[model samples]
Target chain A: MNNHENTAIEFNQVSRHFGEVKAVDSVDLTIQDGEFFTLLGPSGSGKTTCLRMIAGFDHPTSGQIKLHGRDVTNLPAYDREVNTVFQDYALFPHMSVGENIGYGLMIRKVPKSERNRQVRAMLELVQLPGLEHRKPSQLSGGQRQRVALARALINKPKVLLLDEPLGALDLKLRQQMQVELKSIQHEVGITFIFVTHDQEEALTMSDRIAVFDMGRIVQTGTPSELYERPRTSFVASFVGTSNILSGETAQKITGSAQNISVRPEKIRLVAPETETADSFCAADGQVTAVVYAGMITRYTVALAHGQTMIVAEQNLDDVSKSVATSRGKQVRLIWPCSANNVLQDPE
Target chain B: MHYKNNHRPKTPKGLLLSAIGVLLFLHLPFAIVMLYAFTTDETTFTFPPPGLTTKWFGVAMGRPDLWAALGLSLKVASIATVFALLLGTLAAAAVSRSKFFGRESISFLLVLPIALPGIVTGIALRSMMGLVNIPFSFWTIVIGHATFCVVVVYNNAIARFRRMGDSQIAASMDLGADGFQTFRYIVLPNLLTALVAGGMLAFALSFDEVIVTTFTAGQQSTLPIWIFSQLTRPRDRPVTNVVAFLVVTITAVPILLAHHLSQRDNL
Candidate 1:
């Protein structure tokens, strides 16, 4: 009965081991109530496992899991007041959309008329106003996904655990759902613990993200903070893309550099003779490669000390002519010293 | 409509003829029975059935013994199918949902009754029943039939359970349904078609079963037993043909229905 109303979930030194494999190692985490938090990681990095633990599909091998400061490590999923939107949707193929959405209410013995009204309202909330009678198998993939969301949301649990719900949709449809999902969370005002491998999806939707690598959280911060000021090389490269400068090359760029990282977009490509102010860091190199993407162009510069630095520039100018001439030319990559983020080796 | 432009390999004419030949060889006896059920001849074999008449159908329907045997056969088949459905589904759930040691071996044993010879199963049941002092009766016959009927259901149930996966059950629990509620709402609906298909096949198998029923039904006559006993009487040939035709129809319909149900959901 220990109540911390503002804290939705807490994992205290939790570890989950599957025989010899440590799927989720000793980890301490807290997700604030009503916040859209994401666990970002590649496959097998324990993101989904962590989400499952929160939803009570999995239990910690040691330590504790608390929902609102009440220990729930030994509780089964049915006992926990949390719901999950599964990655596969997991909609019952035999049930129609309305039946699936109203299942939780039916279990609670809510009156039939009330259940139906709530189901219809949930369908509308998910933007699927008239698909209540269609079976899960009859709907398209995205429609099935919406039904799954509506089903979990109808119960109105304290927290919603989503395990890569947008992974199966097409890119265009995925982007659309991402916005819808964020808005739905905002409207519902329930804590959402989302797990995803896509960094852009995490950045676009989550209020804060915990980056996971090798069964541990590498860093946790706001999307902009994680992207701009990564604490480790793993977080720097994973959240977005960053060029890590270390050893002698880093030492020459910034005096006595143990390790430092700067984003590719942060460094500007200029003439080799460009003068650097005291507030800026500059490196002279030959442009070894030019990759012209639709929205941006990337230049790979080979420094005199043999370290390559990537510089990305927005395609604001007519860059097609410059793309042909940029390769093999001497260039100076310049960025304000504030753009450099000091890095630490991952544990 | 035009297969010549299709990329699939053309089916050879010889293969098609041989397939037809095999089907004819397999079903030609049933077609002969169908033809003779309407024969005018009361006794002896005759080509082309000599002439056709609907009298044997009426005659077969009039016999009290035929009705009694048919009723008993239906009763035994229905009861045996129910038993098979319950036991087989439990065994399938246990084997498919858990990872206990010897899971594979246990499932293998569950299906062994059907794989073994029917005579062997009959003898084993008879010995066990006698050892337990359980007198041979209608219930004994049902118990005997259910042994192999369970195997048919187990196969169907296990395959469907594997395809259904555990995600829906997990989803059910996460949505606040307890274990029994999850089974009733989530597991049962998903398993309905598979169970129906399995039960139908079990009914068909149990309906015309003679060997096990013969060993278990002491002094009683089921439809199959009556048909087997009538084969020795020359006067009852025409009536026997009609009854055989009825038996074939009764068993064939459910088998076909089971096949249809099982094949409908490949997705």
Candidate 2:
């Protein structure tokens, strides 16, 4: 981990309250320089509020926010060295694309000639050359998003804050823009603090993801770590599809493994009469239902104890031949001991 | 789909009749004024004038008293419009965007003059000016006009400001521009059309104001006051019609122009 001194943004026990409701509660986080950090949460989880505070749009009710070791807790938004791409893009409809991109430079009192040059370069950088004369109303959703990005990046801010920037786009366009945004961030080499409720988007773009719940950070880690070793049930369910089984800790099999969390894909299905004894732990059940997805077959198995378990099988050749025939039949479900992930119970 | 189809209007004639009625209600008075402006008769209005002539235009333009009154009205309206635009925009920005105490009450007071009847406001202003011992002059007329005119500008400016998302301001500030710089480069440009429309509307309102102007102008005669005085004089009948016609044209042009500008903004 990078030291706190080298961090681009550091929130020291920051808290914000809106009337009696705590929107952000004592969050302490360090975003490293030139890294893509994401705050992921459900609606009203306070991710956007935290982003607003960092952008200087909202001041924390208590605690400090430091940018490059300088306290900026009280600074107004315009005084901060950061720019934001809002969810709606919020491009000025009255101004042409060039004027929108040139606004920051004009505000900084850059000479007209230099501002024009920089604006032209940024237009080309966003692959939107010759769109200078077009108003925002004339542009498509993706084009307007590009113009917004260009407008923000033209100033080369120390930190770029994106509040659900791709939320307004169609799914296909959003996926494409996510790649473009990640590449753009890489090229600019600025710290990006992104906020989104989309888990797939966070997983695809962030160097580290912070999961928020009810105004507090529940967990923070890399995409793989968050998915494979989610510390809590909320993180596990939020990040990916997981079939949760309510079971007490049966026993501590070893010092390192305290609880069991088996991924569906890890379980192997076998006919009850043809099971290998030493290959895995066994659970016997009747197939309650079978569903055929494009890439996989999902099965709901009912155990004798009335517990239901979900098992997913990759449809390598023919899904019909592999799992379709087992519907309404008793079967043995098996998985290696290593397939289970042990997680601490959330308080 | 079936429900929507069943409820669809069956009588296109009814729709046409209502549309025509609304159009006539809106434009009939203006059309009458335009028709009478060219009348050659001196005593009373007739549907078809004896003959169309520019005689009244000539008579109205040739009077020095009428010219002086027009000039004074223009002077007062111009001063009031400028003051209203400045103070109205500032007050709008403060109330619309800032989080401060008494915001709702301040906004309410800003719009109070317009909400009340013109006679009430005029009477109140007359009493206040008398109590303060301030002589009623062009400045007093400007102040009275501005009380209502500010509401026009404030409504326009505040509506535009609220429609503007906060992100645009944040983005500009984040790019290293100060508050003034952000407003100048980002905010003002967005607000320009609305401000112009509001100013034009305020100018129209101030230019044609009679009830408030009468109470505020102690000795000075604005164009409306001049026209009101001429209504009682038999010798000045044609001239009064001409001046009234001119006042309507002047006021109507700015208001129409402002409407066109605001419509374009919506588009």
- Per-residue lDDT of B184-239 in model 1, one digit per residue for the tens? 99898878889999999899888989898888899889999999899998985889
Tens digit of lDDT per residue, candidate 2, span B129-176? 999999988889999999999999999999999988676777767776
lDDT of 2 by residue, A1-347 (tens): 33656689998899999999999999988888999999999999989999999988899999999987778999988788888888888787878999889887887789999999999999988899999999999999999999999989998889999999899899999999999999998888999999999999999999999999999998999998998888877887898766455543223222342545667887878878565556466677899899999798889998766667789988888767756577799998887766666667664
Q: For residues A1-347, what per-residue lDDT tens digits would candidate 1 score against the true structure? A: 23487889988999999999999999889889999999999999999889989888888899899998888998999998899999999998888999999989999999999999999999999999988999898998899999999999999999999999999999999999999999999899999999999999999999999999978998999999999999999899888889999989899988866799999999999898789899999899999999999899999999999899999999998899999988999999999999989997854
Model 1: how far is B21 from its true place, Å?
Answer: 5.8
- Residue A242, candidate 2: Cα error in Å is 2.3
Clash statistics: count for each candidate: 0, 0
* Candidate 1, pairs of clashing residues: none
- Tell me the alpha-carbon RMSD of every candidate: 3.3, 4.1
* Candidate 2 residue runs with Cα over 4 Å from true position: A1-6, A69-71, A248-260, A272-279, A284-291, A301-307, A320-331, B1-32, B45-47, B100-109, B127-135
Give the Å shift of residue A207 in candidate 2: 2.2
Chain A TM-score of model 2 comes to 0.92
**All candidates: DockQ:** 0.79, 0.56
